[model samples]
Target: MKEGAKLIHTSRIPVRWGDMDAYGHVNNTVYFRYFEQARCEWIEQMGFPVSPREAAGPVIINASCTFFVPVNYPATLVIRMHAGEPGRSSVMTWYELFVEGQDKLYAEGAAKIVWMDNATGRSVPLPEAIRALFDAAAG
Candidate 1:
């Protein structure tokens, strides 16, 4: 974890057989899905709607991942989620992926989430509840 990065959630996801490609390893795109699962869990647990059709909600501006080792099926993955300091309307979330029972890092990822008005498709200030969560994590 980076300095000042607060771990907010963790998830264990099983690697599915279909996650593998012809290369016999988990497909590169699947790594992002794993990250998304962990991130979504965190958001939902925070009492935020995963998808809001008419109200302000969160949307990803950008996302990225770095694969250090290829993961295979028959494995349970532990994904640790971290949050950086919040901005007015955005926050940077980080993730580290590891196979269960292993200390090695399989991948690391990040996504910048911005609060947006669903009706107007415009950025809006993050909800106070979210800012309070960051503040609690920081302390």
Candidate 2:
């Protein structure tokens, strides 16, 4: 996280009725669901290398989240995500949530994931193909 970074994907989440808490506001955990969807969309859009028996090769090494404003249920939430430049064997994913049609930023967060060798269970540098995908995604 640096300031003024470029974002890759944006996903709109319609807050479900069940997302509410007793106080009539969207539950805190619900925000993470938005983050998950945003990340999934980014990966899907990249169309990285895939094999029939192989899966996406990485594990989240760290994650942190912060909330600035509260959003009530029955509203639409917009989550924007970006993958930062690759460093060693990892990539940093940044996120921000906006409520009320981009009028307000409710939260900002990040997750760091290390490219990994699934068979060996070790962190590995991102493959060149996947790195290119991220570069393209950054645009």
Candidate 3:
């Protein structure tokens, strides 16, 4: 990941009551869910159809998140995602979550996904079409 990366998608996720922890703040794990949704939407928007039947698609191999601020109920989170330059069989996706309409960052995350053959459960090179999609999005 680099500084000033080009973001492919931004999504707003409403903070739900169930997302809060016993401490009255958003639980740490809930932030990853927001990142997941943003990543899925970005891939869809890039013209790649995602389904179990698809011969090849991205699968998360590594993922991590960092939280900086606590979010309470009655607020929305804006998650921004970026597609990194593709590797031979994997791509890195970066995420940043901010309080809606605020500059404060709530969380940051990154994921590395390997294109896999669903039937064989083996890693495979990203399809040319999908590679092009990521390239265009990164540009």
Measured by lDDT, the strongest candidate is 1
Off by over 4 Å in 1: none
Off by over 4 Å in 2: 49-56, 134-139
Q: Write the per-residue lDDT of candidate 3 for residues 1-139, one digit (tens) a residue.
A: 4675667789988999999999999998888788888888877876767788888787898899988889999898899887778888987888988888899877889998788999999999887976787667666
TM-score result, candidate 2: 0.83
- Stretches of candidate 3 off by over 4 Å are 137-139
lDDT head-to-head 1 vs 2, winner: 1
User: Model 3: clashing residue pairs?
Assistant: none
Q: Which scores greater on lDDT, model 2 or model 3? A: 3
RMSD of 2: 2.8
For every model shown, what is its TM-score relative to the native structure? 0.96, 0.83, 0.89
- lDDT of each residue in 15-103, candidate 2, tens digit only: 89998899888888877778877887666566643332454365678777898988887688888887777887888888989885567
Error of 3 at 29 (Å): 1.0
- What lDDT does each candidate get? 0.91, 0.77, 0.84
For candidate 1, the TM-score is 0.96
Tell me the tens digit of each residue's lDDT in model 1 across 60-126.
9999999999999889999999999999999999999999999999999999999999999999999
**Whole-structure CA lDDT of model 2:** 0.77
